[model samples]
Target: MNQELISHDGPGHRWLAERQVAGVKLGLERVKNLLKRMGDPQDTPAVAIVAGTNGKGSTSAMLAALCDEAGLQVGHFTSPHLVETRERYRVNGRCISAEQLDAALVHVRDCAGSDLAVTPFEVMAAAAYWLFRDLDLAVMEVGLGGRLDATNVTDPIVAVITQIARDHTRVLGDTLAAIAQEKVAVARQGRPVVMAHPTVTLAALRRIGLTCPVRKVGKDVQVQDVRIGGAGLGTQAVLRGRALSEPLQIELSLPGRHQLNNAAAAVLAYQEICAAWPKAWPDAVEVVWRLAEVPWPARLEVIETSPMMIVDGAHNTAGMRALAETMAERGKRWQVVLSVRDNRDPEPLIRELSAVSEGFWLPRMQADRMWDPHKLAEVIDLCAPHADVAVGSAQGCFEEARRQAHRSCGVVVTGSLYGIGEWLGRGEIVSPRLRRWLDGQAPQDQ
Candidate 1:
């Protein structure tokens, strides 16, 4: 490793940050070249590539937990970190340390050869491969559409797609079928492709002519006895599939009906790879129960009680609608603190929030991609002419929302993960577990 790049606060992070200027090039040549220079670290023995519009991160986390429970060393790579950049890489349920991240980035930077133009995400993907080169299995979440995503360079044993919806339409396409085709492009020939999306997307995949075998959730695997836990608890369901002789009961720490599909998809992917392991692994039931302990942050996560406040990273229209439906199912009115990335179309998200929230608070995130608060307020007013809207810093908006909310009402902080990270960084929300996890410390019991 380069001595200058090893300092956490020094040139290491700056080197990575400077590459942000290239910003989201949807191609594989740069990443492929970087990996080749790094001795093709992604050529691992076992790998699973997960792609979808919404639930891919949760599915990756669930799959990592199941593999860990079965006594396997697991490495997970996901995107858009909540608090720290190291959160994007994890091994055996723990975030990568700053030292480890800096070391890995040094290798990635050196391997890029000083001439190849690489994006920030591609660099991170390369570093993850270098950091976890010796792990037993790797679970990688596609940062964007799957076809040319930086994480797609690896030859995956199984490609999993969870709940395809309308997102990144400019690059992928405007139609659902077009998006589905891009998502399933990660599927390899003669390998199993696991999916948990609707029939429309399934039909779209078929229309695109999928050559690999597909194991669908509702068709190939059965999800029965679905139940949501009470009072902010997670969800429970039964999973039945060809991989198991009998139905497996599952309990998950992640909430929402959508998460059930993610869990089922993870289980199906696990089944596809279980036969390749050398030792006797845990039973399906045991793996399902162990999934309940996976701590995936900022997805309908509750941080406080009394004037209850929850933070979720729901940016797209479909994700916002799902959050609204989940709130409605609880029979509680909520106050919303919203911020969005500059690239997103905010009209639909604002309309969804207006339907579920009694009022809106518009906060400016510290990140460069955040939308302006003044323009966001105008959109909120246009969508919800009768609703009260406030604009300020995230901390000020959160404070005002808490003061205005009734004791029985819930408060939701959402729109972008960057906003949620800002909220957590300000120490306004007291979640020791999340704090510990971000700081590279083991989480304590709640």
Candidate 2:
């Protein structure tokens, strides 16, 4: 580790960024060893591990908010931050300070030493665990497939799997069963597992077999009366299960019908935690109210109303399908600005977007792994031959989409979160702190 790099916030961030070349080293051995060297800071009594192809971030955010409302000092560790790397490490809904992050990175660098190589995400996961050591509770969102994800190093009190689908097929597997098997690995023996997915995924899990007691949404845990209201009205859901004394109605500020299922899974996981440590949490009503207030960004988020601009981090086929469904229900044929990572399959996403979009804008995300704009446009042309397509820089693409959209038509920014982040940094979306931080860094054309 370079002493200079470990001494400042910018240098520390660059140090982590440099590790991307190492790529994703899936497996817990390095993380586990690093934690052990640091005296096992991840050994906590209150921890929840959430794993899935989609909805994990939102679910984890909901769980963290609910736990915070219950008066516990909650530590939330998520990934692929929208604005800043510090966004991945949060306590009670507030991002960790740059100074704190720098300090934690110094410690993490020391723990890994000069020889033990770990990926950027593994380092961040260790740093978060170390930083959250003093918190009352922690909610960890798996960065990749659950089985060998670095976040799996911790012994979670409860495990959650939300809406499994065909994603990260290169790493997890090609089939749904193989993907389900990897996700279900987060379920520990003798602990409760909460899952919200289709019957096919459940069948896949059954075939793979699980040692932990699993609770399925709409089966063991019931969710009914799911109503997704108009834009900004939020969603309402009725949840019931062995964990609850009676049926509970939850109103989530987050939009989408799929969010209701995520809420059910979060409620079930919280209830399991409450059952194990009854005195640690508040009444169910209070916790339910807090769940409704979770502000999970970039999920069907309507940032601008006039010629509406909605940004969502829906990178996979399942998420694109959900986005398409939501847009269809709203009765708006969107002009979409789409970008995706090189690892993901763009054909299915393009097909889904074409179903609900009037035209498509293909943008090159300002990231190392972004898919080529021309290649993506070629796929878009093949998938939806009739739809109009434009290719350019991320900002230019979004600007062109917004310019072309009619008064009644909205502009939807979908695909990779990095693309959305790049678009957000382009002055259309204003986040003061993020903007200030971004200005200090080297400029990207996007």
Output the number of the TM-score-best candidate.
Answer: 1
Candidate 2: misplaced stretches above 4 Å? Answer: 1-11, 198-210, 241-243, 278-280, 393-396, 430-446
Clash pairs for candidate 1: none
- lDDT score of residue 81 within candidate 1: 80
TM-scores of the models, in the order given: 0.93, 0.90
Over 164-281, each residue of candidate 1 has an lDDT whose tens digit, in order, gives 8899899999988889888888887778888888575567666666677778888767878878656664688888767576888888788888888888889888877785566677
Model 2: residue 72 alpha-carbon error in angstroms: 0.8
Per-residue lDDT for 1-446 in model 2, tens only? 12112224565676777677778789888888988988889996378999999999989988887777777888989877776677677787777777789778878888788777988889989998898999888899999998899999877889999988888788899998889889888877778888887465556556656566677787766778877756453678888777677788889867788887888888888878887875866757667877665766678777776667777889888998988887876665779888788878799898888877878888765566778988988998899887788887666876778787764468888888877776664555543323432343211111
Q: In lDDT terms, which candidate is top? A: 1
Scored by lDDT, model 2 comes in at 0.77
Instruction: State the displacement of the C-alpha of residue 217, model 1, in Å, after optimal TM-score superposition.
Output: 1.1
